[model samples]
Target: MSVNGDSEQQDWPRPSSSWIDKVLFLGTGTSGQVPAIHCVTKPDFGDCAACKDATLNPTGKNRRGCTAAAVVGRSAGDKQESTILIDCGKTFYSNAVVHFPRNGIRELRAVLLTHAHADAILGLDDLRAWTMGGVIQRHVPIYLTQECMTVVEGMFPYLVDRSKSTGGGDVPTLQWNIIDKDKPFTIPASQGRKEVHIQPLPVLHGYFGRSSPFWCLGFRIDSFSYISDCHEIPADTLQLIRGSQAIVMDALKMDRHLSHFSFAQALSFFASFSPPPALGLLTDFTHRIEHYATQEQVDTWRDGMLAAQLAGKAKLSRSVGEGGGTKWWSDIWDERDNEHQMTIRLREKYDPIDDHNISQTASHYIPPIKLSWDGLVVPFDPRRSPSMP
Candidate 1:
């Protein structure tokens, strides 16, 4: 659990010329998505409040698309800011139709894939809109691992080899580039734009068989990292992203999931970093999680950690296990004791008082670790420490 090192030494190598400025979350839901058709159409079914809200309000927080985002920034020598997309999941078209115009994103500099899952790569054909029957944009450069590219090749033979396309339908034009998990590569610069440095972080999505792990690629663009689908992060990856300024991670639900990080697991990993990341965003949610409700839980957890840091000691627990076995758990601010690991739970209520109303100052506030919603635009400055936007 211990990934702490000298904070100064853990800083990612800064981009020589270009850097990412912000990330736009296009989708935050799991593969099935929210307001699932089955749940809404079930006879006399009213069990899920989140899905109900999503159905009633199309653009509400409860409504979500498959997890994906765009890294937006201005590379040196570019006439305008460029947007590099992270994933093109099943809901890519749905998300793009909304967020692209909403954010004024006109150019797609590149597309980076995490894995070859249906939710992650099924939207490959949707790029036709961008290509526009050979009218607007030209061929887009796509980067992915050999395994992911192999899946794309089989699923989209026409895209890889346009000769296979039949019926004279206009297909998306693409130039494929194979990426390696161990190598740090550069996003090929568009006209007048400089190349952007990227470090690939291969994580365990699940397992292929009994032992071999299903690898997914996560990317680190300077101090920001995005891992939208992962069950476990290896020691090397952990060390590589130890002092990230901001991270958009996968937390599928409150309970443990076989292929995604549960709320507890994601928080534990965040706590492992010294002083934690400046901003920690949890995404890839299921209908089981209500947006505001989950944010409240994260707020409570943050308050508890802040309290422990202020007290300078682990607080005593009220409950005792069988045979008078008392349980103690707390999260320290700077770093946890490497010899022991603590399991922290969210409190029903962290503080009754309204801290915002009582005082405008946030001297004791811990960095936010909260859930992300669809169409959420998180702006950050790579030249400085991240702050709320």
Candidate 2:
């Protein structure tokens, strides 16, 4: 299939100018991310499944690092169009530059942070470079749950410091807007006269054994909802996203994970919701899985089994109206696997994408590269590859 370069920044299966506005899955990998600096350094490091096969990776000409999600509206004549970002992971800047270049994005209206994990928020520094160019004059509004804000302040003291009189630092010139979990709020849209309502849907993070109640918030933008780093979906939260046109969520692979959703878990979650017009998997992978092998093997498996079952047995219907009753067959699964060992089966009639396995899966199988024995094959050492680490 011919890949669309702008699909990550534009709405999937539809153009950006579509009725529901634009929702893009900028970055979907897990904490360590794919083609990790560690994995990339290995001597036998070959091509990346997501990059070479999935077609989800950006073009070779302009490669930015990290993962992120962006939502843009269709309002015209608005100079400062509002663009919202969820989870500013370590690769935020490079990912932003690649998917949303300075010229493409006119304004950086707000940011909603799900938690304080390094992969989720380290890219805040890259905003410093954007400010120097004069696109943003004041601190951009950063929305976070009270608990998450505390974690950010503790981790990146300089960025959240309210004491700095001059407001000059590596931070992305942000105006902190701390939000309460489960509450809906309004953010000014592209046109100052208009505003977009965003509802924060809270979910769990981390593993059960070491499970600390880390707060992760998903945003409901118009008909689209974005949720990442979640373990379970509460009934109320599911209600909130019931009729959403699209849901960009975390599918950490096919394995049964302690914290995140496995492919089966994600599919189960998707099954519960009224099928949205589109379904894209974000925060979709990790580094332990073999990109190439997984994609080919899983696609073959999905076409033969999962797709047939869904076509034959899935009873859920899609919602009706612009944002009302659900339609059973409109469900779309833009599955992005990131965890290890997780495998997903597509519903019957759905043709599995070639790069489906580029992301993570719940299955615990190790990649060929990592299975080497001493002397026979040298293990990949991160210290040797400067591109990574």
The model with the greatest TM-score is 1
lDDT of 2: 0.52
lDDT of model 2 at position 353: 36
Q: Candidate 2: deviation at residue 295, Å?
A: 6.4
- Residues 1-389 of candidate 1 have per-residue lDDT tens digits of 00122232132222221266657888999999998887789764368778988988988888999889998887545777878898898999888988888778876888999999988888989888778665547877899999998899999999899899998767898879998997888886667787777889888999866587889998887667889888878867776675567777888876666788777767666644443456778899888687777677666676665555444444445743111222233323211221122223543323434433322333233456767778776666545643211
Q: Alpha carbon lDDT of residue 64, candidate 2? A: 26
Candidate models: Cα lDDT each: 0.72, 0.52
Q: Count the backbone clashes (under 3 Å) in each candidate.
A: 0, 46
Look at candidate 1 and give me any clashing residue pairs. Answer: none
Question: Using lDDT as the measure, which candidate wins?
Answer: 1
Give the TM-scores of the predictions, in the order they appear.
0.82, 0.67
